[model samples]
Target: MQSVERTFELLELMADSGGEVALSDLAEQSGLPLPTIHRIIRTLVNNGYARQQPSRRYALGPRLIRLGETASRALGSWARPYLAELTEITGESANMAVLDGEQIVYVAQAPSPHSMRMFTEVGRRVDAHATAVGKAVLATMPADEVAQLLARTPMSPKTENTITTIESMHEELERIRARGYSIDDGEQEVGVRCFAVAVPGAPAGAAISISGPEARMTRISTDEVIPLMQRLASSLSAELSASA
Candidate 1:
C-alpha cells in the first residue's frame, strides 16, 4: 500500500513537471529516499507507465496517453446527463470543457431546444481568452500562472467585446472570482451570451457553461441561471470525483 501511494505521488510529481523529471529532482520533490524512488520508478518503467528520456530524466510513457484519452472520453459521457439537465432548465445550449495546454476543449454539449441556438461541436478547441468556460477555468488558477499562460497565447479578438489585453483579462478574472461565475458578453460571437461556473472538485481546469442569444439570456434570467449552473457544476464535480 505504501509503495503504491509513493508510486502515484511520483507520477503526479512528474506530471506537474510537464511529464518529465530528473531522479534527483523527484527525490527532492517527493521527500523519498533514492532507493525507494528508484525502485518505484523502475517498476513504473517496466510496466510502461514511465520511460527514461535521452537526457536520462524520466517521463510519462506513451501507454498512459491511451489511458488518459479513454478516461477523458468516459468523463464526457458521465457528464452528459448533467449538461442535458442544464440545457433543459435554462433553455440554452450547455457545454463542458477542460483547459488543455493553451486552449479550452469542449468535451460534451447538450443543444438548446430553440429553433435558433448556439452550437459548438464536441472536441472543438478555442482560445481561453474568448469564452465563458475558458474564463471559468482560468479563474480557478493562480494569477501568476495565468499570466504566464496568457503571455504565450495571443488574445486575438473574436468579437469586439472579446478581452484583448492582459490587464483587462486580469480585472475580468477578479470579477469572476468575486461573482462565482463568468460571462461571455458577445465575446466569442455576436448576439450570443454565455454564463459559466467552474466545477469545484472536478479534475484539472473543468467548467460548465450555458449559451444562447443575448435577448433570451438576459440579466433578468441570470439570477435563476447562475445558481442552477452552480448546483449542476457541484453535482457534476461529485460524480467526477467518485469516478476518479
Candidate 2:
C-alpha cells in the first residue's frame, strides 16, 4: 500500500479506538514495525494530525478539527444559513459541536444579541455532563465507552447544577436518547440554560444548541426547541450521510 493509504489507515485505526493508542499498540494493531510506526507517528505529529501525550500515548489531535471544519464548512453551508435563521427566530445563541473524548468541542456558533448569554469560541471544549450539546451527542455512544470515559474523568461540577455523579450523567444521556434532545439547566454556568439536538455523523458526534439566560431559556421548554433542532439535526445527518 502507498504511504498515504497507510497514513489514512493509521488515522482510522486511532479514531476507532477512541483516539488514544500506545506505540506498541499501534505497531501491533497496524502490523507495522516500531521504527516505521515511530516515523509515521512523528510525521503525523509534526503535521498536526496526531498528538503524543505525556504518557507517550498517541491520540487524534487538532488536525481532526481542521479536517472537521473543512468538511463542515463545505458540507454545512445550508446549515449555516439556517443557524442564523434559528438565532433570529429564537433570540438565543445558536451553536454546533461534536464529541471529542468526553468533551464537546464547539465547531460553529451564532450568538444572539442578548447581553448575558454563553460565549463560546469555535474550538471551545466543555465537559459533556455540563452542557446540552455534550449530552446530546454522548447519548449516541455505547454504554461501555461512555463508562470508560467517565471513569477516567471524574465528574467535577462546573457549577452547582452540573451532574457530579456517573449514575446521574448516565441517566441524563438516557433522557437525551429517549427524548431526542438534551438540556443544560444552569449546569455549566450559574445562570445559563441550553437545549441541544444530536446531529449523527460518522467518526464524529455533532450537536446543535441554543443557550442563554436561564430565565429566558426556561421560558421555552425542551418541547418548544425540539422541532427546530430536530429539523436542523435531520438536515445535518442527511448532509453527513451523503458525504460519507
Candidate 3:
C-alpha cells in the first residue's frame, strides 16, 4: 500500500512539472531517495504508464490517454444531475468544464427551457481566458502558474470584451477570487453572459456555470446567482470526492 501511494505521488509530481521530470528532480520534489524513485519510475516505464524522453527525462506515456478519456466521460455522466438541477433553478443553461492541458473542455451541459438560450456543445474546447468556467478554474491556480499557462497560449479575442493582456487577466482573476465567482460579460461571445464558480476540492481543475443571453442574464442578481452557483459547486464537489 505504501509503495502504491509512493508511485501515485511520483506520477502526480511528474504531471505537476508539466508532464515530465528528471529522476533527480523527482527525488528532490518527492523527498524520496534517488534509488526508490528510479525503481518506481522503471516500473512505470515498463508498464507503459510513463516513458523516457530522448532527453532522458520521464514523461507521462500514451496509455494514460485512454484512462483520461474514460474518466472524463464518467465524470460528465456523474455531473449531469447536478447540472440539471442548476438549469432548473436558474432557468438558464448550465455547464461543467475541466481544464485540459492549456484549454477548457466542456464535459456536460443541461439546456434551458426557454426558446432563446445559450448552448455550448459538449467536448468543445476553448481558451481558458475567454469563458466564465475557464476563469473560475484559473482563479484557483497560483499566479505564476496561471501566467505560465497564459504565456503558452495566445489570448486571442473571442469578442470585444475578451481580456487580451496578461496584466488585465490577472486583475480579473483577482476580482474573481475576491468575489468567489467569475463573470463572462460578452467576453466569450457577444450577447452572452455567464457566471461560474470552481468546484471545491476537485481532483482536477473543474467549474460549473450558468449562462444566457445578456438581456436575461443581466436581470439575474449576482447576490442570488453567485450563492446558488457556489452551493451547487460545493454539493457537486462533495459527490466527486466521495466517488473518488
Put down candidate 3 lDDT per residue, 119-226, tens digits, no spaces.
Answer: 899989999999999999999999998998898789999999999999999999999999999999999999999999999887679999999999999899889878
**Collision pairs in model 2:** none
RMSD of 3: 2.2
TM-score of each: 0.79, 0.79, 0.88
Off by over 4 Å in 2: 1-6, 12-20, 27-78
Candidate 2 clash total? 0
Model 2: which ten-residue window has the lowest total lDDT?
71-80
- Give the best candidate by TM-score: 3
> What digit string (tens of lDDT, one per residue) describes model 1 on residues 1-244?
9988998899888876667889999989999999999999998999899999999999998888787677668879988999999998778899999887668889899999999999999889999999999999999999987887788789999998999999999999999999999999899999998999999977768999999899988853777888989999999888878867
RMSD of each: 3.2, 3.5, 2.2
lDDT scores of the candidates, listed in order: 0.89, 0.80, 0.92
Higher lDDT: candidate 1 or 2? Answer: 1
**Which tens-of-lDDT digit does each residue in 1-244 have in candidate 2?**
6888888878877876778889898788899888988888899999899999999899998978777768655544545665777798899989987776667777777879887777788778788778888888779889887887777677898888889888988888887788888888888888888888887663467788888888898788566668988887787778667866
Clashes of each: 0, 0, 0
